[model samples]
Target chain A: MPQPEYDVVIIGAGPAGSTTARFTAAAGLRTLLVDKRQELGAPIQCSGAISRHALEDVGIVPDDEFIHEAIYGFAIYDQTGERHVHDYRSLKPDEYGSGPGRKPLGYVVDRRRFDRYLLTQAERAGADTWLKTEGRGYTPTDDGGCTVHLRRYNQDIDVRARLLVGADGLQSQVGKWAGLQTHIKITELAGCLQFIVDRVETEGLLEIVTGHEWAPGGYAWVFPKGHGYAEIGLGVIATMTDKPARWHLDKFMTQSFFRERFADCRILEVQGGGVPLAAPLRTQYADNLILVGDAARHVNPITGGGLHTAVAGGKIAAGFITGHLEDGMPLRDGALRAYQDVWLDALGDKMWKLYGIKTDIFHNMNIRERDEQLYATMADYFSPTSEFKKI
Target chain B: MSKQQPVLFNIGWNACINCGACVAICPQEAGFVSPFDTIAVDRPCDIACLLCEQICPVDTITHVPAPAPATQNGAGVR
Candidate 1:
């Protein structure tokens, strides 16, 4: 039997794909999400930290099932271990008014479960999902729709879609298949290594450490999970490191601060990955294609945070998609370019300014000067929530 | 330069997620890793940097040793 044609087919079931699928499917478009893994969120690759407002903006209400811990605020430490804290409650009263859920500034969640939950939302919204499926390429139909070639488990088949949304992450094959330039320059890539440490005491404070002795172009972080669990990792700018990222991470793990904290801890998980520092793509749409999330280079150039952007961008894409599909616009019509314009208008300026400032101020300065300047303008980093840009 | 062997076979087929860390951390001046293409390392360019192997997040890369001269098995077995 042949698979039913879909109005919209999204590749990758991550936050962006799931959110877009939810919105599109809920709006009555036949949507399907395809993932390479049998499970939705295996091989977890995120730091699992997100702001409360960001989560709320994405329509995720924190639940114990996936929400690990509440983060009141986070702190930054210089090489000498002198700390500067960003207390959300005290610092951003105007932005985040007193409320039941607004007290805790953010959350540390089980990213794997959170990702899966997002998939469930999409499924509940009437979208279908194919697990262990991979998209090799697509051939455009005469109607401007595409016959997407997919390999599901051991079988090959062609699925049809009028519009294709690529949320396939930093190494998005969908973007490449659509003939989009998604290559990240080496100098703009940040290498990260993390360990889930158990039996570590966390004071409910998320720690961001800055120093040349550790991560030169980037920073080290300790995001709490609970009473005795947290994720400890450091990201190194490629231009500053000569050896494997693990070598520097290992040194960081041995530091007196980390050593004392994790002395009684055992490593429960390991995660390594890279975050792109490029500004949002100049063009995020082509033909009948739309790219969202990390695939569109929506990650923060300095903090590397992208969850909010992924969710918001997906929502924005879904809005445009809904209009096109509902308006009965043919696949060949130029309406799809609206997605590109809307997204660029929504995110292009913020991304460009952030990337420029990050490269000029953070990347160009000495570690000491960087820390000094960051401390001087404590609100500059987190108050406006500059790193966590929304769509 | 000698023809370099395929050091990491099927590097991005399944487990590799194309994080771009390998490219950023490659010690070789000429080494390149991309999900779009397969030529990650080459003769004189790599110089056996092996940094890609060490830094791969999923550890999907492996090196295959070059074959020795094919001799009479009985004499070479020792």
Candidate 2:
């Protein structure tokens, strides 16, 4: 009988995995984090916008290193070019902070730097990390642990661990291999595209353009990234259109009002990806295996925002795994099932309701006819004053 | 080097961003992120679901007449 090399082996070194490692390793567990990328956060897939409180929730402070710009609030534009601003200054003036010393409602971050910072924090907390290492698959052992197969340095390697944490993002193989039903339908997925452009004017607000005319099954956004640059992107449901997300974005930038605004702007970079709009996975854990972050579909159903949820999910995963190992709980088929229930109590309820609202608003509807009304409905649901309780 | 299996389609690497949407939604687990960080479909196993083609936001994965057999260690960059 051979002992496992590490107490826990976390696949993926994104925010979720790193946060999990930070807590588990700090608790004296032999935690190992693996990522396929040679660089920790290259080829960014996210918009990199997150609430300020979200970073703070995980004990992370907004620093100049990764903070791209401070967001004061959101400005939503309807199809008619009508605008509605949700200013945090009005709701929480004190927290908004004023002048150079002011705090922001949210922030746009440099994801590459932010992700690297998180992994560095995890390593500093005593976790071992392997870069350019991909988790090929895993096989659960009879002893209630698993052997993770990996491809590293062009060679295959196997590692045994008492617990396997699947923090892998969108294309997570670990969760699917673990039989968590991670499949997403075309209608339930948002195909997204973005361009980081320069020479675009931007205020401190996150600008959102809604209506099918702008984006058939999704919406477009202009998120400030500081220093006269911003990310302009949109997402479309593949089932709703024959054209790709890029086509819609192209039309939006050239045929719409943005044509004038982006006339001289330079396209610095292009980013694209798929976002799962489905409900969170019902079971986030199976035996000694736990799925956190996007792997567990912890994203906000309507907004498609997951950074905050990912960080929080990581913390929850770490807490439960640490507790299970410390309690000497039998690592059987259901030893860690409590993690999902706990996560549900903490965050899953709101997500489920939001998923319902998302279905009501976008699923199987005539978007063009109801565009403005739909935009108003969304605004009400998202307004700071409105309780999410209303349908 | 072991001979790789035959693939049903060729990935358009020039435009692919390695987002892994194909890998996430593939029913047969045939689509995977190659060691080079690009998306690759496992040979002799894709079942021609074409989900990868439909799900790719960039529309970079395309079906081909016959993909040349690959080697196990090759990056398959094409």
Candidate 3:
């Protein structure tokens, strides 16, 4: 009964939750960010490879401490061991605004530090944060808000807030309890495995290997993590195969292309999880509730990328919450629903395009046929432009 | 695609987040909620179908593949 009432309560302290808390509290509204885990970034559920613009786009400085490596382009390997190295080097600084000059394709981050760093930002902005707190559920209050039931280290408490934001990843209980169906189709859930290993022969380039033999309906990745350390992982369509991801990783490790190169490597860590890559949910906001990040299924369908979406989404959610709390505007139905409209205006087309590409191209093609067609197409696409007729 | 049906499937308690996705998506009424209403449980793999395995969001429901049939084909797929 002693828990303080707040204007906003965000469940889950990952990137999305922290970003929303950061902006909401900084705008002078009372905010609270809660996570079930003892540590902000424990278990390290991500590949640590995030788009370089993820931080800056949300107004955070991309500090050097968290950056592990800069990727130039991709080296794509197909089913038959055919390699197509494409040089889609990033654009100049002018293209992305006042950022670094001549950017790389992306960056590999120390995600543990990155998540904690964002938490610090939220704390500095005056948001209250609670770790090791799990949300049991919630019930509607008469004042148009809800009382969230929480268990803090075996002790139960109730906290009241006008707005509830669920950033609780793919298995969001907050969203489900708030009357939003958070489950996606099995065809849309991407089960993934990641391993941090040494002795990787990557030359500052990202490697993507695709084939049914390696990963069914998806590709395996080798991300450069600097200092000869690499994060290798794969996502397989759950509907495509019944085999465990570890079984696939063992087979991938023994491939002739990777056997000798990874011979003496030691695996530092292993993490497994699922990513929801369906289109952003039909409604991430209703009444006084909202969802963001993986909970809202905002991940890019093709690459399963989500860091950028989480940051952008957090910022957009805060914008709506702040306006409603401070400007004396309504917070239900039409006004609050605009949160989704504003964000889709900012990022909808890109997500839909990636979804189309994922469903239309990669997901439908069997491994062998995709390899042949992809190899032939990229071979020409990345080849030096040739002059057919001088006239 | 003609492998023998699995006789048993074990659900990993550690991997389950109790999302109720398996219960909602299973074609058969194999999945159910326990007494607490938080954690979920499944009946068994007697259906010979892998729908529960496919529908598990966390990949926690592991399939136990049946031993290879003695008369299965031996032709190389590649």
lDDT scores in order: 0.73, 0.81, 0.71
Evaluate model 1 with DockQ and give the value. 0.18
lDDT of 1 at A225: 83
Query: A156 in model 3: Cα distance from truth in Å?
Result: 1.8
Q: Which candidate is the best by TM-score?
A: 2
Interface RMSD of 2: 1.9
**Interface RMSD for candidate 3 relative to the native interface:** 5.8
- Give the DockQ-based CAPRI class for model 1: incorrect
Q: Per-model TM-score of chain A alone?
A: 0.91, 0.94, 0.88
lDDT of 1 at A123: 96
Ranking by DockQ: 2, 1, 3
Question: lDDT tens digits, residues A1-391, model 1?
Answer: 8756999999999889999999999999999899877765556667877777777876778787788888877687776678877766677765543465456777887878888999999999999988888877777888778888888987997898988888987767676676666666666777787888888777667888877677766778888987578888887765666655666777887874666766777888777787776688777877778899988887877678777788878888898899888887765545567787887777666778878877675654576687665444333565446553242
Q: Write the per-residue lDDT of candidate 2 for residues A1-391, one digit (tens) a residue.
A: 4533889999999989999999999999999999988786667778998888788888888899998998988888887678888777876787784466668888898989999999988999999999978888888788777788888889888888888899988778788776777777777878888999998999888888888887877788889988889999988877778877888889888887778987888999898778887799888877668899999998887778888889888988898889888887876667677888888878888899888877877754776656866678657655777675211
What local lDDT does model 1 show for residue A341? 81
lDDT of 1: 0.73
Per-residue lDDT tens digits for candidate 3, residues A39-71, read 666566577766565677787776776778876
Model 2 C-alpha lDDT versus the unseen true structure:
0.81
List TM-scores of chain B, every candidate.
Answer: 0.51, 0.58, 0.49
Candidate 3 clashes: the total is 0
